[model samples]
Target: MSDREPEVVRRLSSYDVTRLDTAITVIQTRDPALARILKAERDVLRDHRNQLDAFATRMKFGSAAPWHPEGVMDWLIAQGWAPPKGLLMAEGEQEGQVDR
Candidate 1:
């Protein structure tokens, strides 16, 4: 992954299903393995969304937004990719934080 957002991921996140299908088709041509991995990732996200739906019901709130279970860098790391550490820090740069 680059410093910039992954365009395929962006398109997959789009509200339009046609765009998502097109993005998936294009991504498969470039990196078939990654496309498969992302499909699995999407499944995981969908499962989390289901859980969040239940959570929201029990808590009496609106449906919660879908979220990744781990950080972006964590996913990259698992993929054997190393993203720049400085970019991984949260806002305000809390003191004494070394490796998270």
Candidate 2:
């Protein structure tokens, strides 16, 4: 008989849910290449989230820090990984005229 242990899959933490959802959406509709990159990143994030959850579970009874849903989103935004939404001026450098 082999003594190999069974692999355990960790559940996604509350904080990770939003990021995963957003990533899935962006990947599905947008660039497949970017999606592949995001999938790899998501795997890493999932691992971190699992570790954090485990740590939180072990410490005391209820002393876990509140998860920031926008944390990853903000990071992606800052990296300019995706195009800007809402406001649009021009493709290149061009000052916009203020409408009053």
Candidate achieving the largest lDDT: 2
Using TM-score as the measure, which candidate wins? Answer: 2
Clashing pairs in 2: none
Off by over 4 Å in 1: 1-23, 61-100
lDDT by residue for model 2 (1-100), tens: 5566636645455667578668778676768877777777787877667665655554444334343333444444554547457444456645555556
* Model 2, residue 16: C-alpha shift (Å): 5.3
Lowest lDDT 10-mer window, candidate 2? 62-71
- Give the distance in Å from residue 43's predicted Cα in candidate 2 to where it truly belongs: 1.5
The C-alpha local distance difference test score for the whole of candidate 1 amounts to: 0.56
TM-scores, in order shown? 0.35, 0.38
lDDT of each: 0.56, 0.60
